[model samples]
Target: MALPEGKMDVNLSNTAVVLTDPQNDFLREDGVAWKLVEESVKENNTIENLEKLLKAAKAQKMKCFISPHYYYPYDHDWKFAAPLEEMMHSGGMYDRKGPLTMEEFRESGADFLNVLKPYIEDGETVIASPHKIYGPENNDLILQLRKHGIQRVILAGMSANLCLESHMREFLEQGFEVAVVTDATAAAKLPDMDAYAAAMINFRMIANAMWTTEEAIEKIASS
Candidate 1:
């Protein structure tokens, strides 16, 4: 059976790539959560595919935005969080010194993945405020998109079931056309629980469209 797939005719002028949590803690081999998501990450060729998208966007001069995850000291003191947030807090997943200080953020696990750094730090990508939790509700991402006159969002990046999914949901609610790149993202392979499997189902149902890395690159090239 085939799912009713929604497709976006990529327009160079208004299309942007919104990448969530493309940080070391999720993409690097020695990252804090590396052990948990390694299988899916490798299987998806996530790192290379993410690079491909970034390179393509750069080449086309299409705008790209980064919605990162970070945890400051005060955040850990919070009294409540979802189960996954609890794990993130406990494991110090995206620990950073503070918002204004780059002392601990630079080259930290919370930093952008090494391969992605050149693209993110090229002074063109719009790096929004760190999302305190799983979604963009607490950040300036929507505003950033609106500011850039971005309407079609090519969404990609780490951990399929968590931040990526959450971002997709919120972007839809905010009236943006979103297309997720499946091969550019991955999820945890927990025992008897395939996070990637669950995320793919939701992505299909909620996103305006879904594409693989190759497909996204092609659309970007033609846009």
Candidate 2:
């Protein structure tokens, strides 16, 4: 099926790839949140698709922004913890634990995937200051994007219904044209909930457009 017209003819020069929570804590097998989303990731071929998107964006010389999820010792002091926030702490998801120590964050299961390291480590990719919570409001992401003259964002990453959706909503509200790469993201499947399915409904209803990694790559090439 064809996607909406104007949205796919994106201006890569003014566009940025806003990848939310692409760290090992969400993507690697040994990471804390892996168990919850592993099946979905594999089923959706998310890792490979994300690689294609990132690499393609790099090839196009498009700006890239990474919105990583990180939890500090101070975060544990939040007066009110949402259900997911509580779960994140209880399970040590993205937990840095100590303020001065980043051992955990730099270690095996918390770093960017090996396949994605080159693109992220290229020095051109803007690793936006980690989001203290779930969205860009708590981070420097928007400022970084704005500084780079980014007017549109191509979003993709882990936990489809949570961080990805949160980033998309915030980006849209901030007046940035946003497109979600559907196959580049996956979501947790809990006992009674399907996060991916839920996120898909919202994406279709809210995002300017939703594209598969292949379609996004093709669009970028044409642009």
Candidate 3:
């Protein structure tokens, strides 16, 4: 049996680049989860590819939204956690001292990648409330997109098997056309799991379109 093949109708006026977890904890070498994701990140050229997408968004004047992940002190007190949540809580991964405090927030694990900050902080990009889980269901991404009349998305960013993949699935359910920039996302590889491989399969099975950074940039430029 063959799955449906889909293509995106790139309309910048009604399309936005939705990036998930483009933060230090996922992209930087010193990040808490770096060791776990390093191989996949390097294998996919994830960081450089993500930067390419960001640069394209800027050059094309594309609307952009970031769905970040963050955990304040009170978050640690939750009565239960999923496996990844346990891993995140164990070492204060993506931890911000407090919801209202920026104390030591600069250059922290939760901060956006420094190289990508100019575009994200340009006073135009919409930064949604931090999602506590793997998807945007807990955040305001859909609302933000709707407010701007965005019905299609160019999706990219960190931890392919988890947050990014989760975001893709949610967008589909929410009626947004999602095109994943495959190489711009990566996942943690463990002794017992090849997460990135798993995610690639799902992306193929799901997303309306699967594009490389160059392809996405071209579409955006022409859109």
Candidate 4:
């Protein structure tokens, strides 16, 4: 669907793909976030669709920004950890246990780095926004986008109702054209999907358009 008040039909010619928290903690079958959006994660072929989208974006020579979730060693800071702590204990997405600390979890799962290594090696712009809160975190996302002269952003990643929504709102506030790829974004889980859908509906009503991965790919290809 078209963005409610914002412009439709963005010029992908200079658009950037801003992947939000596509980490093992979010995408892997054993991921905490996966448990939340397992159905959509599976049904939407989230990983596969993201790969396709990434490939298409690369083929078009679009800019790419990766926003990976990372938590420093300290007390609880993530917003969703309270109830999750009692319910899932250390099994939740933000919880750390065993030999792997939260920082380690982030480092190991930042495979997107490897995926985009070639581009970086080739002198392409690769922005990394780490330890970012929903959207208000003092990350380098905005600065990187401005440095690259990027105006349009294609968002994809986990927890559609949280991280994705936060980034979308921030981007919109910054006056950037934003597009959320539904197939690439997954909610926390079933009942949560309802919330996710509602948030997307609200997002569509204000910030930017929400399109399926296939539609996003087609638009990118056409552009």
Task: Name the top lDDT candidate.
Answer: 1
lDDT of 4 by residue, 105-160 (tens): 43354344344345433556475656445663577878888888889998887668
Cα lDDT tens digits for candidate 2, 64-110: 88887777777787899888788888887777756466675676455
lDDT of 1 by residue, 96-145 (tens): 98887889677788999988999999999999998987899999999999
**Root mean square deviation (Cα) for candidate 2:** 2.4
Runs of candidate 1 exceeding 4 Å displacement: none
Model 4: residues with Cα > 4 Å off, grouped in runs: 1-7, 75-125, 190-193
RMSD of 4: 4.5
Q: Which residue pairs come into collision in candidate 3?
A: 160-186
How accurate locally, in lDDT, is each candidate? 0.92, 0.85, 0.91, 0.68
What is the TM-score (0 to 1) of candidate 3?
0.97
Indicate the residue-level lDDT of 15 in model 4.
84
Task: Please give the lDDT score at residue 17 for candidate 3.
Answer: 93
Stretches of candidate 2 above 4 Å error? 1-6, 97-101
Off by over 4 Å in 3: none
Q: What is the lDDT of residue 66 in candidate 4?
A: 74
Question: Regarding lDDT, does 1 or 2 come out ahead?
Answer: 1
Reference-based lDDT, residue 222, model 4: 80
Q: Model 2 compared with the native: what TM-score?
A: 0.92
Assess candidate 3 and give its lDDT: 0.91
Candidate 3 per-residue lDDT, tens place, 69-184, comes to 99998999999999889999997799999888899999999999998898899999999999998999988988999999999999999889899999999999999999999889
